[model samples]
Target: MPQLILSPWFFILVVSWVIFLTIIPSKVMNFYFNNEPETASTHKPKTHAWDWTWH
Candidate 1:
């Protein structure tokens, strides 16, 4: 059987594709599924921004 020589460009291309498919999607999903609801729920609060000054 022939062997596939892994060049530097091939490594870079694979790493980029992995990051594109995996990391970006997880971040987007986390934001959409987790953070979106938290932010949306807190958005309607009557609290003022100055509330943090007491802390």
Candidate 2:
């Protein structure tokens, strides 16, 4: 019904779903990907000097 579609609760529900779809997936992916355990070997050694010469 048009009345149901225009109701405040329906509006709130739609907004909630939009927020969930837009926000939750990125947060979940970040949580899983960013929270991975890191090992020292996984890091690249820092270069102390920059080589200005082009090879």
Candidate 3:
């Protein structure tokens, strides 16, 4: 138990989890909130019925 807690691997695992919990959520939220909303102007034009005919 004491040896397991004192091991370098355990320390690394603890640090990695701390970074993951602390950094990942903020990054995800920033991307979610700061992302641009899609607009009509950016939409592709609708294809006409005849547009699919071989030219």
Candidate 4:
């Protein structure tokens, strides 16, 4: 197993990467929530009509 040396810059890079990764999911979830509500109404008929309890 190869061990990489830890340094100040390496810690900074790791922290930056972690922050970047977190931001991506946040933006994706934001976009998802923003778009889903608009499209959700269209699907409601299909989803609701299929269920007997709804009628």
- The TM-score values for the models, in the order shown, are 0.43, 0.43, 0.44, 0.37
Give the per-residue lDDT of model 1 (tens digit) for 25-47: 98887654443444345556576
The residue-level lDDT of candidate 1 at 40 comes to 42
Work out how many backbone clashes candidate 2 has: 0
Instruction: Between candidates 1 and 4, name the one with more favorable lDDT.
Output: 1
Over the stretch 1-55, how does candidate 2's per-residue lDDT look in tens digits?
Answer: 7665657887898999999999998888766455668666876877787788977
Looking at model 4, the pairs that clash are none
TM match of model 2 to true structure: 0.43
**RMSD after CA superposition, every candidate:** 9.8, 7.7, 6.0, 9.1
Query: Can you list the residue pairs that collide in candidate 1?
Result: none
Q: What are the per-residue Cα lDDT tens digits for candidate 3 across 1-55?
A: 7665667987898999999999988888766555578766876888866565665
Clashing pairs in 3: none
Compute the lDDT of residue 8 as modeled in candidate 1: 70
Highest TM-score, which number? 3
